[model samples]
Target: MKKPLVIAATLAVVLSLGLAACGGDDSSEETLSNSELIAQADQICTDYNEQLDTMNEEAALDENSSRQEIATYISDDLVPLYQEQVDELRSLNPNEEDAAAYNDIVDTLESELQVVEDDPEAAIDAEDP
Candidate 1:
């Protein structure tokens, strides 16, 4: 009887551990702690800086490759990244201003990206340089 009880206890422990693992890190844009969401917002700012650098360097390259690469980078990387970040940021509490700023960044950047994609020459002409 003692052996059976010990085995059951061990099984319960193992099951609990497995469940904990399955819960995973629920810290995306929509499900995160406050500090974690703030950290994620800061990370998105960093990513924006990186993308700016990439865009500047790409613009100077004078090749179709640069624009193509940037398009892929924007769609494959930046879009999803900021989307997730904004969702995560919105999940934060008592940070309405910061969340609004994050959402605005996401919207503005996405809109600009669509325009650039659809009308590269017009977008370039309209840009500040």
Candidate 2:
């Protein structure tokens, strides 16, 4: 019984240390391969595209897009930090399909932003003519 208890404690300590190493900031400063970076950008674009589609169909977006900090977060969190990665990926593979996808997403966001900026009240509600 005493031997088993000591073994269990040692196992627990080892497991905890392993977990701590894995849990630390998963975002690595290590450079991503071109393909990996493109994949990440593609996913972001896809998500942003779907979100804007929903917004357009339901309600026009206000400056803040119904309190969603998407633009805010993208600008501050994504762009500032990862813009270089995105640019690198684009420059490396300018003609990639994912690059076009990313551009479409950006265009959608811009259009939505314009709608909100041009007509704040109209954007807040979805009333078709």
lDDT of 1 by residue, 1-129 (tens): 122223222222322221211111234445444455455555544554465456445544333444444444444444454444345433443244344544454455455445544543332224222
Predicted structure 2: lDDT: 0.35
What are the TM-scores, per candidate, against the unseen true structure? 0.37, 0.30
What lDDT score goes with residue 65 in model 1?
40
Query: After superposition, which runs of candidate 1 have C-alpha atoms over 4 Å from their true positions?
Result: 1-39, 51-105
For candidate 2, the 10 contiguous residues with the lowest summed lDDT are 17-26
Across 57-118, the per-residue lDDT of candidate 2 in tens digits comes to 44332343432333333333323223332232233332343445544543443444444444
Error of 2 at 96 (Å): 19
Quantify all predictions' global Cα lDDT against the true fold: 0.40, 0.35
TM-score of model number 2: 0.30
